[model samples]
Target: MELVFCLLFGGPSMVGALLELSKNSKDHVATSTAFTFFRLLEPHVYFLYSQYRFDKGDIGRLFIAGLGSSMLLGIIVGSLADKQV
Candidate 1:
């Protein structure tokens, strides 16, 4: 069951990460920063799920929170980039 869950999420995650890295190949700093951020974020998320006993409600909350955070980060970064230019 855990293996099934891993395959379901891990495959897409690996592909997505590869594509992102490929897209940023010309920017070493961006690539490294992204990798480092994800490396730190993944463990914290996993720990939160494990601590919560992997409840369905908690998972849903986590998903929503992830989306919100990503959206907020995108907005902040876009604004910063605009300011820089």
Candidate 2:
């Protein structure tokens, strides 16, 4: 089950990393792979942490909180990128 979850999330990430690797810059491979792994780890880490910290009855609150945080993060990142340009 975990293997399938990993493969599903990782397959595209690995493919993108390999594509960058072929471009012959070791730095791109290292960075992209690290980013991919961290991104994939995020939701699992959140889920586990929620399970440890919150009651099952709090699912609705957790869902709302997750959505709000994610949306705020996206907005902040977008603004930063826009500023960077």
Candidate 3:
């Protein structure tokens, strides 16, 4: 459970950190907020369902989905940055 939370949150933060390094200061706040809101919310929604005793695999699936979404978003951002530069 904790590992799920860590991955969902940590992976995005690492992505955000990389984005921050690449983007100008003016863009960091918007980018960070956008990442945090979407990335962290998924596991939490799964956690709420788990409170009702949903199977562990269901929660794992949610974590995986969130991680995949973040990775896709990161790729899009990277590609856009490449275009900009």
Candidate 4:
């Protein structure tokens, strides 16, 4: 498959950070493919979400900030979650 060949020809850095984090996972190729697929879709998904979520304000600000923006309120809880772990 294309993913297998990519892994074969490329270095670990080209594949991504997910592979580095999942070093003990049984299937490196599958982990890379999943992370790669998510990376491709994440930006588009955020763009679409900004359209509806911030209909009047500066959508670009939210898009640029991604998840860390206080608009989502997740950042507040993220601090708590990080402390627990």
lDDT by residue for model 2 over 2-58, one digit each (tens)? Answer: 999889989989998897767855444355777889889867866886878866557
* Candidate 3 global CA lDDT score: 0.87
Candidate with more favorable, higher TM-score: 1 or 4: 1
lDDT of 1 by residue, 8-83 (tens): 9998999989987787546655457778898799678877887879976878788889999999999999999999
Give the Cα-based TM-score of candidate 2 against the true structure: 0.34
RMSD of candidates 1 onward, in order: 10.2, 10.1, 10.9, 12.2
The regions of model 2 sitting more than 4 angstroms off are: 1-57
lDDT of each: 0.85, 0.80, 0.87, 0.69
What TM value does model 1 have?
A: 0.38
Sorted by TM-score (best first), the order is: 3, 1, 2, 4
Name the weakest run of 10 consecutive residues (lDDT summed) in model 1.
Answer: 23-32
lDDT of 1 at 52: 72
- Residue 39 in candidate 1 has what lDDT? 79
Off by over 4 Å in 1: 1-52
Tens digits of per-residue lDDT for model 3 on 5-63?
98999999999889778987676445677788998997788779889898889778877
Highest lDDT model number: 3
Q: How do all the candidates rank in terms of lDDT, highest first?
A: 3, 1, 2, 4
Give all TM-scores, in the order shown: 0.38, 0.34, 0.39, 0.30
